[model samples]
Target: MTVPVVYSACEAYPTVRFVIATQPVASSLFVNPPQNLTVVGVDVKQRYKGTHGIWRLMGDLRREYAIDAFIDLHDVIRTHIMGVYCRMHGIPMSRIDKGRSEKRELTRETGKNLHPLISTRQRYFDAFKRMGFDFGETFTSVYPTGADTTLFADITKPKSGGERWIAIAPFAKHEGKIYPPGLMSLVVDTLSQRAGTRLFLFGGGGYERDILEEWACEHPHNVTSLAGKRYGFAKELALLSHCDVMLSMDSANMHLASLVELPVVSVWGATHPYCGFTGWHQNPANEVQTDLPCRPCSVFGNKPCQRGDYACLRGIDYHAIVQRLDNVINQR
Candidate 1:
């Protein structure tokens, strides 16, 4: 999520020469970053304690590049350590305002009136504003050039008279966010029956692979499974970009699809987009969610259902979602 936001800043302000300090995992996420952006991988596992973080940067990049200011957007205890290093080095710095108070109101159990909070992307821009940079542009995802179409093989793009390609990513990190598998099977079955429609199932893990494989075998020619293929991100991202529409849980796929500007029919379970985690430039109108009183019980959908039954998710009508997808597909 934060990846695109930082990319936008670097893209919008090409003259700034933004040096992005992040965990080592980021090295995999932002492959072939733009000219102005330089990602410095910090050993997050080390906790940046003792002689790590700002101290390390101060000794190396600071001496070489003549460093000026610091902006710690994470604002976590770990990043705070970097801020301390900035102060000791006499470099000016600012941290992003996470909009904690607004988020609190959106997620609170009692006396809650739900409304959209400040977007995480906007907050990143606001962080830049504090550093005397005003970025008025919207967020966009960056992908490798000439994204291979061959990896998709028989799953072609939607032609004027050809198949409408659909990617179904029906898993989230937690059970709270996942739509019922039986219900998702119905979505696959209905869509697969349509003339010139190809359904591709996307997910990871052996268990997810088994599930997708079973569905693919059941449907035969129309359904193909992309799970557990280990195609690597560069290939998967290109393949994802080829899709016409992505039916997904409110997980990474929503944001991943947004990068390619592919429209998403995201099913919300325990987490609401109102908490400011919606994908870059994704329309809220396309979102599929019921307005249950206990809609957003957890920010990340990792919490156990306080109601025990998880009415927030089980109560959602899958048929309604299918109808909505029909509408979205026609518009596309």
Candidate 2:
């Protein structure tokens, strides 16, 4: 989505080139990206380690691209340090407005505010706008041409008859945001019984694999687990393009599904969509959540529930998720 957001700036100023500085691992997500845009793979863990590293990065950027302006969407302590380097170089720059105060109101334990905050993308657009590179809506995050289909050919087969494919991402980095594994398995078991539907379990290559694989084995004919697969990001993206709808927690998978312009039925827990983390152009109606006063107890779902039990998550019945999935599948 950052590529698309910045690509709009490239459109407005045809002479301009964009240096999309990202973590080394994530650079693979872009395949044959725009000619005007250069994706710089930065290793914050290795190459750019401290203040000295940031200074080196600044020098490299100047020497490599002779770039005049900087827009920092990643408003972290590290990026702030990098912005200082940009200032020292006499470069014009704009950092993102994270709307921390607005986010606070939404996540507070007492007298919670339910109004939506300005979206992260809107802030990105605004940051570029501050640099006088005004642009319109972002482009879809679809893969560029020349993707290798063979990567998924052996692992994934064509849908038989009027079959519909559903991708279920049942894990989040913070357990507070994810539905319980046992309950999610129940959701999978129920969905597997649906006539003309096939389930695909998605997760990172870790302990998440064990849980996802267990659910997949139970419905061997109808389910497949993509966790810890050797296939790269581009291929995983290509596979997601074929899913009818992504059933996900408010996590990266939901955002990834949106990148391919796929419909997502996202389940919300401690993190509310109102906090501006909703997937790109996803319908608010598709958000499945139990409405409680303390609904959005945390912003990123990293904080523990003050109520002792995480009723916000554990209280969500398995049937509710399945029913919502049924509606999303039929409506789409």
Candidate 3:
């Protein structure tokens, strides 16, 4: 989600050399960043273990990169410690206003204030503005010319003239956000039956690979499973740019597709778009979710369903999801 925002910042302040520190797992997404941007993969849990470790990490970053002012996008404890280090050194700093109270109101069980809050991307832009940096949204696609399509040539073939390519990311980190497998299989079955329609299933892990493989086997000619293929995010982005639409949960895949300006048909379960985690430049009309009062019970969809039935997800008609995809594909 922060990928495009940081990229925009880099473009806005061309004179400033921006250094981004993120988890190692996410570093792959920063492969071909702007010239002014440098990404450093930080193993926070392994290397920066304690307050002292974070303090030391700050010093290392400062000395190594000639640090000046600090803009803390993540206001977690580690970033708080980093702010302290900067203040102690007389380095100016600013942090994001996470809108904690507003988010609480949006997610609370009773009297929920469900209007959309400020977007996470907007919050990031505001943070930079508070630090006296000015910029507009100049980002378009990571692969301006388009991603190197040759990377996955083995599995993906050139799109035919009438082919409607669709990508489906059926898994999220939490169970609350996942569409029921039996229903998802029905979706795959229905979509693959259409003439000149190609379905690509995206995921990772052996369990996900097993499921995707089974689905691909069911629709041998139309469905291709990319799970556990070991192709990095760059390659995935390459493939995504060619797709007409992506079907995903409230997960990273939605944002990844957004980076390339691909339309997304996102499924929301325990988490709602009102939490301000919607994909960058995505249309709210394309979001497939039910209007249950207990919707958005968790901010990240990590919490167990309070009602023990996950009615918020189950109540959503799979046919509505298919229709949403149809609209997106036909419109394109």
What ranking emerges by lDDT with the best candidate at the front? 3, 2, 1
Per-model lDDT: 0.78, 0.82, 0.90
Tens-digit lDDT string for candidate 1 (1-332) = 66676777777888878787777755556745778878777774564545464467556657766668888788987678778877887888989898887767777788776888788878877887898877665545455454556754544443335678888999999998998888888889988998888888889977889999999999897888888886665566677776678999999888778776778889998889988888878888888887878768778898888788867667778887788788878897
Please report, as a residue range, the 10-residue window in candidate 1 with the lowest summed lDDT: 151-160
TM-score of 2: 0.94
Q: Please report how far candidate 2 places residue 332 from its true position, in Å.
A: 2.9
Measured over all alpha carbons after superposition, the RMSD of each candidate to the real structure, in angstroms, is 2.9, 1.9, 1.4
- Pick by lDDT: 1 or 3, better one: 3
List runs of model 2 lying over 4 Å from the truth: 144-151
What TM-scores do the predictions have?
0.88, 0.94, 0.96
lDDT (C-alpha) at residue 292 in model 1: 79
**Model 1 misses residue 174 by how many Å?**
1.9
**lDDT of candidate model 2 versus the reference:** 0.82
Ranking by TM-score: 3, 2, 1
lDDT of 2 by residue, 175-278 (tens): 67988888888888888988888998999877899888888888899899989886777777777877788899999888888777778888888899888888
For model 3, the stretches where C-alpha displacement exceeds 4 angstroms are: none
What value of lDDT does candidate 1 attain over all alpha carbons? 0.78
